[model samples]
Target: MLARLGAISLSLSMILLLSMNYGSFALVGFLSATGLIALVVLHPWTARLTDRHGQGKVTAAAAGIAALSYAAFLACAHWKAPAWTLFPAYALAMGSSPNVSGMVRRRWAHLHDGSTRRAANAVEQVADELCFLSGPILATILVTSVFPEAGVLASGVLLVTGMLLFAGQRRTEPPADPAAGRRESSPLRRPSVWAVLMPYALVGILFGALDVTTVKHTTSMDSRSAAGVLLSMIALGSAISGLAFGKVRPRSEPRVPFIVSVAALAVLTCVPLAAARLLPDSLPAIGAAMFAVGIGTAPVIILGTSIVQACVPEARLNEALVWPSSAITGGNATGNALTGWIVDHAGDSSGYWVPVVVGPAALLAAYAGLALHRRTDDDCVAAEDVGV
Candidate 1:
């Protein structure tokens, strides 16, 4: 998940900047969108590979492909190569991401059960928050202190080293499942899978828009430097809550936690808008709102993923896990593009509404999942009962 953050947050701006240098801002947007699209399109393939070949081998191979893509990127930047090469380089690299978060969650499911798995998920969520909180800062420092390509290079190295080390932990790896290949049909056909995925995509939109909107909002207040700081506070709040959440065993099934967390998230997501309206000049107020939003975010993810772990077939676990992330990527891209437009025309303050509107969409998705779970209660058992 930490490594995934580097790709999502760190190398992202670097890729955009490199693309912009190659051609126009249109190229930048195009590549960024294409990279995300490629992730959605190619992610299922990686899941299939992971399930069939084992996580270690697939991850190692994917990291290698990503490394080579970065190498191509470096060569292009060095020689000032054609701008078009950037497309393939980025597509190949992002397409080869290996769904690190999904793999980690799968392992957690493999090793733990019930409240322990929930606790483990919480721990992973905390790690995820820390990664987002620290990864971008690290990348920014490296880029500014070293070179333009420094962040990408560092990420590439980390990708290789980290995946290699992670892959080496054979005892922790999930065994290859032959059943994953039995059905050439995708997991998208499963209503249970899509129920979780649809809302997650909505949540992803909230995430992506929240990011771009925060930057715009901070810049509008002439405190652009505090944007990252404010965002870090948000992540900090989530990490703290994640720790607390892990310790307490929820009295209900995963669905209840999922619904409540998302409902809280939907409401808390509006706080930023209120802050923007009421204290237009106060970045701190906006930060406070972001912190609240963060608090709700982790539990939603933790419970949602726990439910997904329980709901999907063990053989198709990798594919099931990747769907939510893919939906997130797709939704994030949608939110960024849409909010960017809103920020340009409607104004920065209006950008907050993007998340506001999308938050309920996420809630609706959660409710859909709950409804589906009610209808097919037997299908949605505890993770331990599923015995993946």
Candidate 2:
């Protein structure tokens, strides 16, 4: 959660600085995409290193590099460096920051299995929502009240501190096998891998679009200040539901979480879409509907993490884990661009359609991969044993 908070806060600050320097939203989008692209491209290699070396060793080293990269990026921005320099510097900073949330989840899987793991996943999801809830607000406050570069500087400190603290937990850290990558083939070869990741990516679409639409909705309503309140409803509902969802033991059926959450999402995502039409100008109605939709969001994530854990060899788990995140990052970028265009051309309310469409696509992906999900039982099983 600290990693998420730091990464997001830093992204927001850099975005603001870029906006100040360039005065072009297009350039802001480009730089943001560059950072995300570096994450998607570089994380697999880092995860592989984590599997081969150790989480503490690998993440600590990477975080150190990330902190230095952040320093360089900030220096460049502060000195009013040329427009093109920001993209590469920001990309390095983003790519080098450890995916600490993934590492933490990896640790949870190391500690628990079955129902206990489910509960742990819930806690992580709650923490994640809380980070999302607060990170942007924190960044906005620091940038506005303190200084233009204060947000960037603070986020770097938090990230390095979080990684160092997490790394120091030597007793609980998972043992890294130096030869695992050599012995086990890459998890990327499994066709069912995409099956597992695609649904989650669709979930990302729902979330990414939800955020953009929420802000746009507030803007259209002529109450831009209420945007944070509306988004808080969604995050608050998800966090509450996540705590409750963890207590409900999932049945033995393998596809239960995968199929069920997507189905719920398919139905629940429509609530906001419906509210946008039925109560066009009612912020209370929209906020209430958003909270309702948020109720179904966390389970999809909680179980989704569990499903990923079940679907790959423990030896290759870290690398396999990065794929879902890559998929989500890409999906979020897609959802943002797609919905932003709609908000600009059609209407702010029309932005909800992207999620509505994305929900059923996820459902289809869930069912389409049921056989694969059911057969993927023990993560420790040899990678070669997972049949195509």
Candidate 3:
């Protein structure tokens, strides 16, 4: 239920905000960037609160605050509120971003062991992708068929309902640790945590570039209506890949998937550039290529996440997980903002270049990490022998 609430809130809010005034690309970009920053800033506090109090209490509070924020946004919209009022309201709504994935992962780690834990993590990843795909379409229908504000209101309702249900579940809430206080004192001081996170930061940048570039490219080629479809295709592709990957048996070296996924993504990146050259004037052709590109996204994300989960200690798992989320959000926000500026000043031709540059850079980062892993394989052998 916590996961469901988080998904609904995030999906509904994104679709409503993006679809309502997508014509104003600059404003959308600015709001997304700022909102992501606000969320990233609040993450540590959110994690700390959950650790100290409980996942239930923290989740309930965040959901309630998020619901109120949505309500305020609706009221502001009704009253023709200026940017000053709306901006804060928007930031507040986004800032209450739920740590649903992290929370679930922690719970899974606590309840399960060995291969079961890995399977649970993979299932969660697939679920995340599923939510991303379904959430937007639901939001799109609500906003377009009913009213724009309706989407926001619906988000609040879903958030409240899901949170209440989740909070009621005994097993869903994590068991309280006697040493929780000491454990939370200084999580980031560990070197292994940083080792797991550093590469993800670079991957996050690539994801961000891909997300914004896809949005900008589709909107330019077709219409704002097409943006939702394009985004949906990407999510759908990822969801399918994640589901398939999750069902597979565990391998001796999980990094094999990680390496393959990143390589595929790098190669797939060229598809857009090819589309730009070969079908320069064809929207349909570009959309097809975008969909194919989406196919590689989920596998890369899931594999990378699996690698991180395997690398980190159980105690530091939650803290380590937060970095990837923060990195992705930060990357997406920065990439969208930068791409928006480039498109505005440099013309549509500049949009294709975003992916072209980011793709190779991300691939290089992944390979470099892989190289480091190989060099340290002898030392890691004892660790891997134990089986995470």
Q: How do the residues 1-388 of candidate 3 rate in per-residue lDDT, one tens digit apiece?
A: 4345344445335534553544455665676677777777787667766666777777777877877887887787656666557667877877785666787787886677666766676688777767666666666566666776666677667766776666566666666444665754444553333434555565555555555555566556655445545556656777777777767754556565666777787777677668867877676766676667767877766655555566555555565567667767777677667766776677664666777777777767667667666655432323243233
Residue-level lDDT of model 1, residues 1-388, one tens digit each, is 5465666454344433453356343344456666778898898888988998899888777777878887886677657678787778777777877788788988988887766777788888898888777765666556545776777777777776677777777998889976677854566766667767878889888877776677667667766456666777668888988898888777666666777888998999899899999998998898899889889888877777777788776778888888888998888767766776677667877888988888888888889877876777665675445321
Measure candidate 2: CA RMSD. Answer: 3.9
Q: How do the predictions measure up, each by TM-score?
A: 0.88, 0.86, 0.85
- Looking at candidate 3, what is the lDDT of residue 205? 56
Query: Lowest lDDT 10-mer window, candidate 1?
Result: 11-20
> Which sections of candidate 2 miss by over 4 Å?
11-25, 75-83, 219-229, 278-283, 347-349, 371-388
Task: Identify the candidate with maximal TM-score.
Answer: 1
Candidate 2 structure quality by residue, lDDT tens digits, 244-337: 9877775444356668877987898888889989999999988898788788888777766666676666888888778887777767666655
Per-prediction count of colliding residue pairs? 0, 0, 0
lDDT of 3 at 200: 57
Candidate 3 wrongly placed segments (more than 4 Å): 1-23, 77-80, 184-187, 214-222, 280-284, 370-388
lDDT of 1 at 206: 85
